[model samples]
Target: MDLSAINPVLLLASLLVAATPLLLAAIGETIVERAGVLNLGVEGMMITGAICGFAICVNTGSPVTGLVAAAIGGAALSLVFAFLTQVALANQVASGLALTLFGLGLSALLGQNYQGIKPPSFPRFDIPLLADIPVLGPILFRQDPVVYLALALTLATWAFLKFTRAGLILRAVGENHDAAHALGYKVIRIRTLAILFGGALAGMGGAYISLIRVPQWTEGMTAGIGWIALALVVFGAWKPLRVALGAFLFGGIEVVQLNLQAAGVAIPVEILAMSPYLITILVLVIMSADRSGAPASLGRSFHASH
Candidate 1:
């Protein structure tokens, strides 16, 4: 194994790129869970978004429009989950699983014409002076716009949960929907909106994979990133910053193992490839033994009587 063959800087840079989708999906789910609703259809939402974004970007020749379409597609699909769970009082877990299956099948249909197609290029901004720094510059500044957006999103989510009145109210509804309803808060509406937000973000994350990561459409291109994002939320205890931190850790593992494969390491190719996912999941699963910080009413159906 030629350890020297791996370029540390490039490895870290790729890690950031790899983790972007995971962070986006995980953080969005964190919000949904915090609102006391658990949507397990992230995989479904992501794949739909991936196809939507890829198709739009290819036709319109604009990555921005493609991303917007992705978000809309995701939100529209999530509307089904919202109505079923919040309004119809259907089972959230089952609804989410159904949504995933539906999304996979639907995306496959939509993406049939888009197979083997490449998407339009997305521009990255180079911070004038900061991007000029020796080692840190390329790793930090020379990144996809979505990477910066994901970071900003983490900070924004943290602040919203910690300092905003709206945030407090959302937290309250999540903690005790009955009490929140008694106090005049609209539990179902809040949760529906949260679910939509989660879907939109998950969609964007999916688009990132097709439009930026692989920049191509493939059946099951998302693999299990959506499921991994769910695990990340649990690993991070549903906190925005911690979720981001966990994404980076798992993302780093993804990059490291790929580097190992490229370096022609003696380890079995299958083992090297799977180690990032298996180790990340096992480690995070082990660390998540204490679920004390989870939102109290998470995954519970809330029927508001007003």
Candidate 2:
């Protein structure tokens, strides 16, 4: 158990990196849920985005293009979800589960050719002045653009949900679709758009895993991060900032386990492997006491005729 082998600076930096995917996925899902739609295909969207981004980046040799392709791929898969739930009025849970199965299979097929290939290097931003600060600089300012984008996006989502008229409409619909519809807001439109946005973010998270996290294609590389993001949305009570906080916390623990393993900690390998998910189970258990209810219309199909 060589605890000293773990570097705090590296651990903090890695924490941000690990948390980015979760933040991106959770924040996007936060918006979707806020609009009163529950989509469970996050895992599927993420894997699809992972393969799409990896394939595009490999072909074009551009991480930027790869990320874009990832978003598009995720959104494209999500469109199926939008149609089934928002258009065909299918059960949200069933549709979302199907989406995951489909995504996993689709990614396996797409990634068959991409196996063992390395992705292009992603450039990190080392802010000249800020990154020079002792301890804090490397921890906070020295990060990839995606980390900052996830943070900025969370803030923007918070502001939008709290202050914007469109946000209000979305919230209104989430609280009660029938009332929002009585006021002439397009319930289905709002939810469809929200689902698309969520899917895109989930995809970006997936890309981060392939293009940045592991920098290589592997079967089912996203693991269960999507489901963790789902737990975060509820853990944060649908608040963007809270969701972000939860992501960081979870990301921090994930990094800790990795560092511990690297440090030759005496902990059982099996226990270390399950540490992150253990935290998730603990969080969910803690949340059982929370009275912060979900959006009133969440998971309930919205029909214009109704």
Candidate 3:
């Protein structure tokens, strides 16, 4: 392995970009799971958002519009899950799986015409003075707004879950819906809101892939990152900071694998291609070994017994 072929600065910069989508998706899933609703259709929502964002951006020539539309599209699709599981009382897991399948097919159809189309570029903002600092400046200051937004969202989520009364109520609802219901808390209402919030974030993540990362529309382009995001929520033990760390870890692995492939490492092409996923699986296995941090009422259907 020729380490000299790799620029550590560029690798680190790419790491932040790579981790952004995962962080966005995982953070959204964390919210959903913490609200005691396990919507396993994050992949579905992500792809749907990808196509929607891509199409909108391509047609109107506005990345911002595309991103907003993506969020809206994702939330709209997730409402299907919310109605089934929360309102209609359908099985969360089955509904979630169905949502994923549906999303993939839907996105494929929507993106069929958009294949190979490039998107408008989002401007990167360089912080003056601070952005001029040695190595850290380029890595940290020279990034698009989404990267900074992702970091802000993580901090906001952490604060929300840790300090806010609303956060406490959301946690209570997740821990024991029955008790929360007894306290006159609207369990379904809170969960529905959480589900919507998660869906919007997931959609934005998908948009990031289409509008910024790859800067193009491709069918099934999310490439299982949504599943990784779900696993990351668990891997991070349902905490925002931990989730960010998990995302960065995966992002680093992805960057390393790609760098290895570019450097013409002797490793088999297929093996290098799958290294990030294989590592993610290994990490998940290690993280799930201790599941004590999980929300107690996760995946359970809630019905207020009058």
Candidate 4:
């Protein structure tokens, strides 16, 4: 075990990077659940985004275009869910599951030609002054733009949920859609918008994996991170700050596991690979102690009937 090979500062930076995708997906789902909608197609949307982003980036040689394409791809898939549940009045859970299945198959088909191909890299934006500081500088200031965006988005989401009128309406809807609808609030509209936003964010997360993390294309590359993001929403009790903590904690665990393997630990390779998921299961078991804070209308189909 070569403990000397691991640097604390580098580890912290990697954790932040590792957490970014999960954070983005979790935050997006947080918004969806806040509006009384449960869309389980996050995995599908993420993978779709991954392939769409990679395909676009490969053809255009532009990372920004690829990211935008990813968001569009996710939103498009999410709209299918919205149409099924929100408009067609289908079961939210079943529709979401079907969406995931469709997304996986669609992405696999879309990416068949792009296998083993690498996309353009997104350059990290180093802060002029803060990046030069001691340990804190490198860890916090020298990350890519998406990392800063994720943190800022979390703060913004917190403020939105805590202070804004729309936020209050969203919470009200999630707590009781019938009451929200009676009070002239468009529950379906709000939920649809939330679903779209969640899909866009999930797509961005998928793109981050393909464009920045691995910087390559592969089938099923999202690797179930979307499910983790879902668990994180529950783990956070639907709070943005708590969700952020869950994301960071999971990200840290992933980084540590990778380091352990790199350091030549004697642990079984299979066990080491399962470290993050194992921790997730354990954490979810512990966090499930109190589920009273979940939205009352969560996973329930909502119709205005107006």
Each model's C-alpha lDDT? 0.91, 0.93, 0.93, 0.93
Tens digit per residue, CA lDDT, model 3, 214-254: 88887789999999999999899999999999999998998
Model 1 lDDT per residue over 1-306, tens place: 799978889888899999999999999899999999999999999999999999999999999899989989999999999999999999999999999999999999999999887788998888789999999999999997889998999999999999999999989988989999999998989999999999999999999999999989999999989999988898888889989999999899888888888888898889987886697669666977798878999999987553
Q: What TM-score fits each model?
A: 0.97, 0.98, 0.98, 0.98
Q: Write the per-residue lDDT of candidate 4 for residues 1-306, one digit (tens) a residue.
A: 898999999999999999999999999999999888888999999999999999999999989899899999999999999999999999988998999999999999999999988787888899999999999998999999989988999999999999999999999999999999999998888889999999999999999999998888888999989999999999999999999999999999989989999999999878998988888899899989999979988988876663
Model 1, residue pairs in steric clash: none
lDDT for model 3, on a 0 to 1 scale? 0.93
In candidate 2, how many Å is residue 76 off? 0.6
Clashing pairs in 2: none
Query: Model 2, residue 303: displacement in angstroms?
Result: 1.0
Residue 161 displacement in candidate 4 (angstroms): 0.8
Off by over 4 Å in 1: none
By summed lDDT, the worst window of 10 consecutive residues in model 1 runs over 276-285
How many clashing pairs does model 2 include? 0
Report how far off residue 301 is in candidate 2 (Å): 0.3
Candidate 1 TM-score, C-alpha based: 0.97
